[model samples]
Target: MKNRAILIILSLLLFIIVTPSQAQTYQTGSYQTGVGIRMGNTGGISVKHFMDGRHAVEGILSARWGGIGVTGLMEWHKEAFRTEGLNFYYGFGGHLYLGRYQRYRRNYYYESRGAIGIDGILGLEYHLPRAPITGSLDWKPAINLIGRTGYHEGGLALTVRYTF
Candidate 1:
């Protein structure tokens, strides 16, 4: 409980720290590729690329609930409230999970018991004009289809990436 509060606070602080004020001028052209770390409901590494200013693809490799998994998303972006480097995005994706579970005091093989799910993401991202960094806050909820069938509405995360 306490740790969760701290995590929320820290995420908010990162958002505040990364937000830019008006009167700041960004470079004429921003980079297309980025790599970063994501922390939240599940912690992991993320890679993203902008095919253009408004369309992008992101990939995530992470561990969730003590299990390793990977996800890929295709997102659409739009400017945020007149902020030059700020944008809001939404996307759809899927995930593959390789996990192990104990049942009735027995250990099961992970390969034989894996989960697959569809994911949806919505987030706000800020690209630092003068630095090679970007910050984002997002909610990524998923519905499990294989192994476990249900809706998981708990996918909120904060990410920071080095854009190049």
Candidate 2:
């Protein structure tokens, strides 16, 4: 019917008009690389590599409770507020933890079991105009899939990483 056709056309026009036209500005090239320590009892260094205007990958290496681990993350970001220099991102990643520990009192010990898990991250980042400095605060929650050990196995961490 003509009424149905008109409704569909109106909806498409509204969608196009309401959508924001903007792109995220990213620091690229070798000079844009950054290295900084993230805060928390489990401290780590974060490295970010921008693949394009809207995508990036990061790697983290940290030590906690005498264990060392590595994590890799991929994120998709969107420019918010249009040049307000703020970016919001969501990502999923995984990690590996390894170390050594004692098992029992009967002269028994074993290499600490390595752990693997998936994590979700939500964060906001700010970039200063004309400067190579960037800062971010993120909440990351991870679920242990391999070694189910303690209460601390699943929790949230607030992290800040400096980007060049």
What does candidate 1's lDDT look like per residue over 69-160, in tens digits? 89999887767777788887777789888876434424653333677988777789998889999999998877678976567765689999
TM-score of each: 0.75, 0.67
- Candidate 2: list runs displaced more than 4 Å: 1-32, 100-112, 149-164
Task: Tell me, by TM-score, which candidate is best.
Answer: 1
* Candidate 2 lDDT for residue 88: 72
What's the lDDT for residue 79 in model 2?
68
- How does model 2 fare in lDDT? 0.64
lDDT of the candidates, in the order given: 0.77, 0.64
